[model samples]
Target: MLKNPFLDVEFVPDLMWFIGQFDVYDREETKGAELAVYNPDDECDREKLIVKYGLDLKCLSYRHKFVLVRFLGEKLDDPNFDFQSLFEIGEDCAGSWPRGEWYNLQNPKGFLQDVYVNAKKVWKKDLEKAALEDPSTW
Candidate 1:
């Protein structure tokens, strides 16, 4: 009984392409540097999603980042999906800088993998719905 219907789709190249533009950096190093370094000028439908979600690049584990891309791809397939809500959710999920000492001390990969798994479980219904609707074109 998934509520959102985009999770079941296959890999989305467009979303992946957009996600590839952002390179994760050390939280401290990103302070003064140009944010544009991570984002290119290439325009696409996924740009807005990138802008919101990409801001959390540093906080996300490398693998967890892909989840966002896949999620976006699913949303793209749904004509009725609300772009505004997606953007808002992205903003809410953006991680904060100067991560706690405990967070910095933990294994980032392991931590993020856990996060990703939990997220998938929470959004499973939505993903299943999406997959059922479009069956993933790609």
Candidate 2:
């Protein structure tokens, strides 16, 4: 039996929802091959397909784990994911992940986007406050 790594962590409800979505992606017989063949010009259409049929669950989980580790300060055994560079894109930019080549697709409902956007907003506010208090830290 495959071991569950997240058994002990206190996952927020949205993160758990993402995990459930990834579970569906994992259990599907085709293992997300259905998403692999789709090539849509509009990103919204691609996200609609993903919401309808799902994409690579393992890949999605890896991304979630990365956000948990890198942004949320949760540590787990490294899954050897090599896509950390892509996650560094700024707030206004669209990013790509390798799985299914789902280019320019960002689900507004996704936990990663929520965490990232909120984190950036908080950081900007904190930085502005900090700069006023201590210009040397800038």
Candidate 3:
């Protein structure tokens, strides 16, 4: 049995929208074109990515935030895991945001870590709670 009452309730657009922002999504759509031009070493490129993702940092609901920061965090660390095989991006994306999490960032790892560092500074308690607590309990 699960602890969360909303276990069956899907965190859709929030979750998928989060994943769709990074180069990971573009890598799938553009045949690795995003991976080719994305230069993480470039300061301008890095800053651009930071601002892009940072703007939408608070858009995620609490549960959705954890789902992104934690699981996506894991995916960032894994070179072998291919989440694209299991999921696909398409035309009908949700949310009120104009862009709807479609940045095609240069570096997913840097984007995540940078966002985590900045987010941890302001949302320390919330981020930490999500980090420490097991998702199974949520």
The digit string of per-residue lDDT tens for model 2 on 7-82 reads: 6553332333332332223334464454445443345644444444332234323334333324332312234432
Name the candidate, 1 or 3, with the larger TM-score value: 3
Among these predictions, the greatest TM-score belongs to 3
Alpha-carbon error at 40 in model 2, in Å? 6.2
Task: Return the candidate ranking by TM-score, descending.
Answer: 3, 1, 2
The lDDT per prediction is 0.38, 0.37, 0.48
- Tens digits of lDDT, candidate 1, 44-138: 31243234443333533333334463665565557775432211223445443322322232332332233344445554655465545543332
**RMSD for each of the candidates:** 14.8, 13.6, 8.5
Each prediction's TM-score against the native?
Answer: 0.29, 0.26, 0.43
- Candidate 3 per-residue lDDT, tens place, 45-105, comes to 5455445544255655565555656665666578885543323344574322112223333
**Residue 129 miss distance in model 1 (angstroms):** 0.7
Off by over 4 Å in 3: 1-8, 12-16, 19-41, 52-55, 82-122, 131-134
What's the true lDDT of residue 22 in model 1? 37
